[model samples]
Target: MRIAVAQMCSGISPIDNARVLQNYIGDAAAQKAEILFTPEMTGLVDRDRARAMAHIYPESEDPVLAAACAAAKHAQIWVALGSLAIQPIESGSEKSVNRSFLINPVGDIVARYDKIHLFDVDLDSGESWRESSAYQGGTQAVTARFGETVLGLSVCYDLRFPALYAGLTNAGAEILAIPAAFTVPTGKAHWEILLRARAIEAGVFVVAAAQCGAHEDGRKTYGHSLIVDPWGQVLLDMDTEIGVAVCDINLQEVAKTRRRIPAIANRRTFALPKDFG
Candidate 1:
């Protein structure tokens, strides 16, 4: 299978983001890609909470979601829209949810996954974020079926949790999508390392479309959209560029890697030590 990853510097305008996504869809289709993956917060990236609140809408009403659907339909390609900020169905903890959607070739939503792990950190760079204050975390993990292959869905911060990948792989996921809008400091230090590790351990292909460059919201993102094979081989890396990359997805590699390592099957569940502290 052939796929495309779009590395973007998403602005604060949903409409503008929609237009950018449309162009990426066209570009990926032109390159004969079957599916296109985009970065997290593909629609809006604003630090001003009050300003961003006005654009937050349900999945049905989100302009970016609607536009992406239309673009996918016109292009006749599937789209693994990395993630979108949408209003949750029922949540009192926060007003919105970080969600990922899988749109089929016909532009119908086939699966949805909300980001279970929220990013709440205070960096030494003096950057702080209380993501939960703006969006609520999801409780369930999700995977999708695409062209006879299984796909695991996850978001930016979820990459840090390896157990999630283990569960996904055990559930028959051959590929994992970890779309992100990572901060510069975290991105430089751990982005590639973590992605490669996940691919190596799970023996699954890891595709990460990332947001890069400075944004209109007075923040910068580390942008190195990466695609790694099951054996931890780097196939494609879009570095610090706002563009799209099309590559082939070799499922055979996944099988070969798993057969070689068999880590997933060899995992043993042991009870934790009691009263260690």
Candidate 2:
């Protein structure tokens, strides 16, 4: 299967971001890609909560999401729309939800996965973030069937948690989608290593579409969108580029790699230690 990843620097305006996505969708389709994977916060990226709140809408009402669906339908391609910033479904909630949508060729949403891990960090470079303050985390891990393959869903911070990937693979997911908007400090150090580890251990294909370059919100993102095969091979890496990277992958490799490793089948449970001291 031929898949495309869109590496873009999202701005604070949802409307502008929508236009970028539409172009990428058309570009991916023109290349005969089956699906297009995009980065997290594809709709809006704003540091000012007060300003962003006005743009965030419920899933049914979000214009960016609507545009993406329509574009996908028009192009006759599937879209793994990395993540969107949208209003939380809970009526009285003030925070929004970081949500991922899987759209079929007909432009219908087949699955939705809210980001389970909210990024909270204080970097040595004096960069601090409290993602939970602006968005509530999702409790469920998500996977969806796409033709002959099954896809495991996750977002930026979720990539750090390996057990989630384990469970997804155990549930019969052959490919893992880990869309991200990582910081420059961490992305350079741990991004590729972690992705390679995940693919190697899970024996699954890992696709990570990422946000790259400086944004209108005054923050910079590390852009190295990657596609790793089950054997931990880096198929394509769009290093700090604002464009689409396409690669053809074979689903049969998933089975071949798993059979050779047999680690997933060999996994066993053990008791934890009683003391932390």
Candidate 3:
């Protein structure tokens, strides 16, 4: 099947972001893509944690979510609406969840996966992020079927946790989707490496759509959106632009790679060695 990964530069306005996404979706559809994917923070990117929290709403009330569903139905292609900030159900709290929606071609939400890993770190560049301060962490890993392929869902920080990918692979996922808005420092250093490693380890196809360039919040992102095959080969990559990378993926490759390596089946559970002291 032909798949397209969209790299975007999102700002603070959901309307504007949705328009950009609409155009890209149209382009991908014109190219006969069966499935399309977008990056994290697909609706909006606000550096002000408080403002972002205030803007959150239930999925039904979110304009971007509604628009994306309509677009998916119009395009007749399955779409992964990377991640959006969603208001929590709890009352009297300012917490939200970073959630991804899997929309079928009929514009129905088939499955949802909230970002499991929150990025809470103090960077060496004097930039500290406490993602948990504003966003509630998700507890489940999810996968959905698109044609004959089972696609696993994951978001930005979740890429750092190998166990998540392993779980997805074990759950019969043939393709893994990682949509991210990674900081420049981390993206440059570990983005490709981690993605390739995950693909190689799981012996599954990996599609990563990402955000790039600077946002209105004065934060920069590394935009190297990539699509890697089961053998850890990059099929297409977009470097710092609002564009789409198109590639043809054959599901048979997944089985072939796994048969050649068989690492997933060879996994062993063992206790750590005793300490010397």
Which pairs in model 1 have colliding backbones? none
Model 3 scores a TM of 0.95
Residue runs of model 1 more than 4 Å from their true location after superposition: 92-94
Give the C-alpha miss distance for residue 219 in model 2, angstroms: 0.8
lDDT of 2 by residue, 28-143 (tens): 99999999999999999889988999999999899999999999999999999999988877647878889999999999999999998888889787978899998898888899
Instruction: Rank all candidate structures by their lDDT, best first, as comma-separated numbers.
Output: 2, 1, 3
lDDT winner among the candidates? 2
lDDT for residue 43 in candidate 2, whole number 0-100:
90
* TM-score (C-alpha, index-matched) for candidate 1: 0.97
Which ranges of candidate 2 are over 4 A from the true structure? none
Q: Which stretches of candidate 3 lie over 4 Å from their true place?
A: 90-93, 272-277
Q: For candidate 3, give the lDDT of residue 237.
A: 84
Question: Whole-model lDDT for model 2 versus the true structure?
Answer: 0.93
lDDT, residue 153, candidate 1: 97
What are the per-residue Cα lDDT tens digits for candidate 1 across 110-153? 99999999888898879788998988888888989988989999
Candidate 3, residues 3-116, lDDT tens digits: the string is 999998899888888888878888889999998999999998998876775567888889889888888889988888899998867544568889999998999999999899
